[model samples]
Target: MRRGGAETETDDPTEDYDDTHADGEAVTEGAGARRARLRRGRRDSAWTRALESRRVRIGVAAGVVVALAVALVAYFSPLLSVRTVEVEGISAITDQQVQEALRVPEGRSMLRLDTDAMAQRVSELPKARSVRVQRVFPSTVRVTVEERTPVLYFEAPDGAHLIDSDSVEFAIEPAPIGVPKLVTEHPGGYDAVTRAAVTVMAAVPPALRLEVGQIAARSVSDIRLELRDGKTVLWGGATDSERKAAVVVPLLGQPGEVFDISSPNLVTVK
Candidate 1:
């Protein structure tokens, strides 16, 4: 047969089928190649995302470390510097005396101040029995002193002095307030009777303290009390001081020249 612009022969349907099959195979191979390229691109993008996440984490961690280091340095460095010193609870002893006792100068590092050593040194003062020291941050130091209360005033070879319960003496210019004077023939009485007198005085009511004029102890057993009214109390010894003081107070309430409460149950008055 003759077709338009061409001569036609018998068509081989099997050949045409083979050509169509070959074309389908070529299209399938092209599609597979395109899919492979897309898969490779996705893998590269995922690897880039992982690397970026790691870098961000590393940067954050580094920043945190730097901030911590700076904070630590700033916190400790200023604590080592001291700016001010404050003194409290000191009356008999001067502030200068306490400062001299502590031996810690101003502008010295707070960390370098030894609290234990300073406390020990402060205790060496005759009046100081207990001491405490504290350091406040950013450069302030506080020292507190607890002084021994004088129980009696004694006359020594040096001068008149105030004596504490421990028999330790401190020199006072005007003497102590609210403390009784002790007169004795022997100076040794100050050491022997000071403690006993403190106990007796404490046991006595506050109303009777000013009424007491003098305590005279010639010997340990021969202790006497002189009242403001010029009457003598023949307190024989230091034994049963609380009981004796208890009895003496009530007896003194009545008009009496002398009262003896040395015996536990007996009240002898003259």
Candidate 2:
């Protein structure tokens, strides 16, 4: 092949074409491999994303289940049950009476207590004017009661009937001091004269009320007040009671045996 002094090319015309063809094939294969690698990379990334999303969903569902279980345990378990009942504002009615009325069983869950129903039950007691029942956390139920006050009292065959400012006959207990005695033909709310007497008594000021020993009503229009000092007052009726109450106070100083402020506009002291 190198017969001449200057190097002469070999007579292999297909060699250059073959080398070029092989190089082209190598480049095509490399490009195809690169494309395969890219596709694999994309598939791997998509699979990873799907796996992460599925894990998050599973985690959320598990958390919800755990929370619900905890809630159920808190709601029904005896760990948060009531062990004691605390009563407040109770004087007329004994704590044992109120507790009996409540009827809440031992070991009842605080969260499961029907507070409204309990309060309603306790209020059934005549002396309990208003009641509040609540759970005092882990182990106690609290009951707050506002007892009825005796504004006036009437004697009956059995005992004294106590009346409050609302004209309700609440109890038959002995009347407390400073409470006025009510006297009427028929001493009850059903009688108009009884209502009139209580209405007039309610209008009397606290200071003047202490001096009033007895209030009698013959009819709805004829109400009389007997003071502790053996003096009498013609209170007329339920009408203009506020004016009558205001006029009767100063009229007492006038050395009168009978004070007539029944018609406050035309008052007389005799």
* Most lDDT-accurate candidate: 2
lDDT of 2 by residue, 151-194 (tens): 88999998999998778899987899978898887898677788
lDDT value, residue 223 of candidate 1: 72
- Candidate 1, lDDT over the whole model: 0.73
Model 1 earns a TM-score of 0.66
lDDT of model 2 at position 159: 93
**In candidate 1, which residue pairs clash?**
none
Residue 153 of model 2 has an lDDT of 91
lDDT accuracy of residue 46 in candidate 1: 99
For residue 203, give model 1's deviation from the true position in Å. Answer: 2.9
Worst lDDT 10-window in candidate 1: 13-22
Output the lDDT of residue 234, model 2. Answer: 94
Tell me the spans in candidate 1 whose CA falls farther than 4 Å from its real position: 1-79, 105-107, 188-190
Candidate 1 local Cα displacement, residue 245, angstroms: 2.6
